[model samples]
Target: MAVGAAQYVRAMHTVAVLALDHVIPFDLSVPIETFGRTRLPDGRDAYRVVVCAPSPGEEVATGAFTLRAPYGLDALRTADTVVVPGTATPLAPLPAPVLEALREVAARGTRIASICTGAFPLAATGLLDGLRATTHWAAAALLAETYPAVEVDPDVLHVDNGQLLTSAGAAAGLDLCLHLVRRDYGSAVAADAARLSVMPLEREGGQAQFIVAPWPATPRGAELEPLLAWLEAHLDEEVTVERMARQAGTSTRTLIRHFKEQTGTTPLRWLHRARVRRGQHLLETTGYSVERIAGQVGFGSAGAFRERFKRTTGVSPQGYRRAFGGAGAA
Candidate 1:
């Protein structure tokens, strides 16, 4: 099965979720619930999700409770995609049999993904050695320390390296699964799945948005909260550092400092990202032309909008729309 293939080929895509011992219950349930509930336009199921374990019928402890999986490692052989949920003992050595099974599945061109610290076991198979991967921010340092060959990015909600994918902690798993759904079935179907899951089709930012940082002693950092909301509401306006400073009641230098401390980005860069995010939503949900969307997002011209949109999203406006836009997109 090809990645992002046409909808027909994905009608019955098999997704095998590997539930190891001590698997986080939430992580294990994400794919099952997301894929299991997804329906095609004709009312057919999008994916067939199955829970498999290293040993079938054996009780696996999940902290909250112990349950028996109906399938074993052999289930992976027939799956088009395999998902590994996070485990409590992420740093513990993986059993050689499990590692060998994962490697064999990868060699057969099966797509694999990990949720949270599940990246630890996936890394143990050496498939992620040269790829960019992510995990729960709390365990990022340990993951990097343990697997120096794997490039660990602690900021993004998820990293998709074509065949191998990894997501940040907890709810970020939902983002990754929704992304996969979008890839397989386009935006409209994915949007329906997102609605069923009670999650936004796409989150505005990455896991970095969830990271907590120490605030400065001054009240300036707290003041930016309202300014951030103001920026979102005025994304279509021509925003400038001086304008943001005025809105925040601070000097440009002070505003810049506070933006970096609070949001980890410059004010202008944040505005650009905000515009792109808005542009993405418009493209997905509206019948607006690129030129129209460019202006709506505050770009001076369609040409500049195309450049910045591609720079931030790795695809031209048309390309993104083609992949994720709704039927109404023009």
Candidate 2:
């Protein structure tokens, strides 16, 4: 007599997440939340996300909490996609088992990803050698120095090197997730996911916004501080270049030089970015009409606001608001 056997069919997008000691709970969970939350337009799940570890039923210590992974390294062997999140205990080298799994998965045409400093593990595998990648801005320098073969850029929120993708940090991971959805299913599915999650359709800007309103790492002298604060608080004001120069107690030429030196950009450019950010905040967080948000953010009127917003963010203000707004039914 033959024993009855059960076979499991793998999902097309099998996402395997590596859970190690001292895992960042939030980063590690992002893949599970976003990918698991998604479904195909046909009402089927888009991906299967599994959290796996070295051995079956292994326990992992996540700094603040202890968790058990029901699956083993075998899960990585057949995964269509693998994701690595930053670990709290990354000072140590990756475990041999984990490294082996990464090597095995990647050799089979599986796409590998890193969220934030997860690049560390991937870089160690040498797959990212000579590939353009990025991590959190705070780690870009370290990543470059640590893995000379990887081209690291800290400016953008993330970088997509085809099958390999890396994100800046926590929230940037969300952007990368949505980007993957857009790539796989087109903008419609991704937009629906954004709507379901109650998140912005897309991020307004890059990780550069993480810098700040007017200050860089090295603080400027007290003279420019008050002016920047004023500009931030009152973006609606008619902030002319001449006015900024006067407020900084310098000529426009001198102000331009100082602004470039301090912020790596002209005052005008910086102010434009700030206003766009403000406009985005208003759009997402308020129920105000587009015209009202435009005026409130110093756009002078809705049409001008649309033009400048599209120029800066590549989408019209109304579109941006529609995407980001916790809006009532259209």
Candidate 3:
């Protein structure tokens, strides 16, 4: 009999994290924390994480402080995967030796991923040419301008192009690392790692949500806050733009304008996202039928709920539940 992916084991996978000078501490720590903590069902460590710099024991500044890596560039030669963390000076030219090493490893079929502005160094290696990639939304424009051959998508949390991948800023690194774990083992293992990190195994939407500005501190915006709270509390009820306007003491036209300005989307669209998020939580924690979940989350029918859920999350409710549902789920 063939072993299932989650049950199959070989020698421990080696993940080498490449930390360069002026590395961003948060980006440097994400993969280390995520991969270092993952465990197989048999209670074995899932991966061997090694932090490597261009020169081991050399102090690398992280804006806030400096530290030394135990391994050197040669470690990349033996790694199954290589993760490059962002640096403070992302646009700065990469050291020739570092760039050469990355190209060498990638040529050998070693998987490579970048966190936030780390895309700069990866792009500098020419590996991202003609590939879709993303970085911190704030730096997306620069990444595109500097590397016209690379497609920079500012809206996604990450882009996986088989052998190479790139993640958006900050916390999106966690998403990318979890995705890699899922790709290597299975969703059950990835879900366990997510629980350890106190994060959902798969977050809805993308980096575009973070690019939106927060509600301005104005009277109109302030009123919308209470209206939003009310909407959440009444998600199971029939909601309409007109009803929302009435709750906020505004005309429907004005309410639409305020939502566009403050939330970067129409009121109904926001409600739909909230409903899908609620549905996901319920599916993860309960044994309730999909029809029951749809009704509880305010969808008019199960069919409509399934359509919207898949559109928003790229998976069916049942599929998501199968992957992430806890012991309480049926």
Candidate 4:
């Protein structure tokens, strides 16, 4: 006699979150909130999120609280996508069973992602070798040192390698999750999700913003800080090297040398980047015409502004505006 078997077919996409010991609450919740809140154009839920632990009914330790995951490793086997958040102890070895499950799922074509130092565990799976990846800026060097085979880039918010993806710390996870929505659906759908989260559809700057913004803690950089502030305040005016030197009370030659020593670039190059960053903000937040924005940002003409903007961002002004402009903007 044959026993009757029951099977249920699932239509909604499944996202499994693997919560290891000492998981970051924010990182773990990002996928659940982002994917869980998404709706199809017709208003149906887009994804079903399942939080799982290494073993069934296991209590995972978060700094603030202990969470007993309802599902076990079995949930990952059938998930369409799997997300791994960073553990409190990133250097600790992953359990053999967990490693085996991740390898098995990845080999079966399941998409996998990690947030922050989660790259550590993902790298251990041998999935990110020879592929570009990123983690929190503070941990980037360590991640690279720990996994030399993985090309580590600490300058971007996230890196997508088709099947494998990694994101930097904290809020960058939100950026990565929204990106997945864009990849699976389209920019419009992702934009809707972004709006729901009160986030920009697409942020303008990359990790360079974080890298370059902090003033160097040196006398050389400190001396130039006032001049940099003045430049920012007067971006709409013509800012020649000679003018900057005058503002800093130095000769042109000395000023150029100091800028290179402090900022790793010439004053003019830095000024151009600042202008472009400002232009990006305008395009994303304002309804001003490109020509007007060009003037506002100190470009001599719309043609000049267009050229500089494209050279800096790899996209035209109008294109960037359309892709990331305010919801009410045209």
Quick one: best lDDT, which candidate? 3
List per-prediction Cα lDDT, in the order shown.
Answer: 0.86, 0.78, 0.88, 0.85
Candidate 3: tens digits of C-alpha lDDT, residues 41-156: 88879998999999897898898998999999999999999999998899899989999999999999999999999999999999999999999978886787789899888778
Q: What lDDT score goes with residue 289 in model 2?
A: 87
lDDT of 1 at 208: 49
Write down the TM-score of every candidate.
0.64, 0.64, 0.64, 0.65
lDDT of 2 by residue, 1-330 (tens): 322323123435788988877778988988887888887777667887898877657678888889998778888887887889888755569889888888887888888889888888889998999998988766766677688789876667788988889888888888888888888878888888777766776887666545333224333445556777788888887889999988878899988887766555688877887887788787777778888877887878888877777776656767766666674433
Instruction: Estimate the lDDT of model 4.
Output: 0.85
lDDT of 4 by residue, 178-221 (tens): 99999998998889899989988777655544432322223244
lDDT of 1 by residue, 1-330 (tens): 333446666558999999898999999999999999999887778998989998997899999999899899989998999999999999878888899999999999999999999999999999999999999977886787789899887778899998999999999999999999999999999999999999998976566444432112122347688888898799889999999999888899998888877655688887887788788878878889999999999999999999998776657788777767775733
Sort by lDDT, best first: 3, 1, 4, 2
Q: After superposition, how far is residue 78 of candidate 2 from its true place, in Å?
A: 0.7
Model 1: ten consecutive residues of lowest lDDT: 211-220
Q: Lowest lDDT 10-mer window, candidate 2?
A: 1-10
Best by TM-score: 4
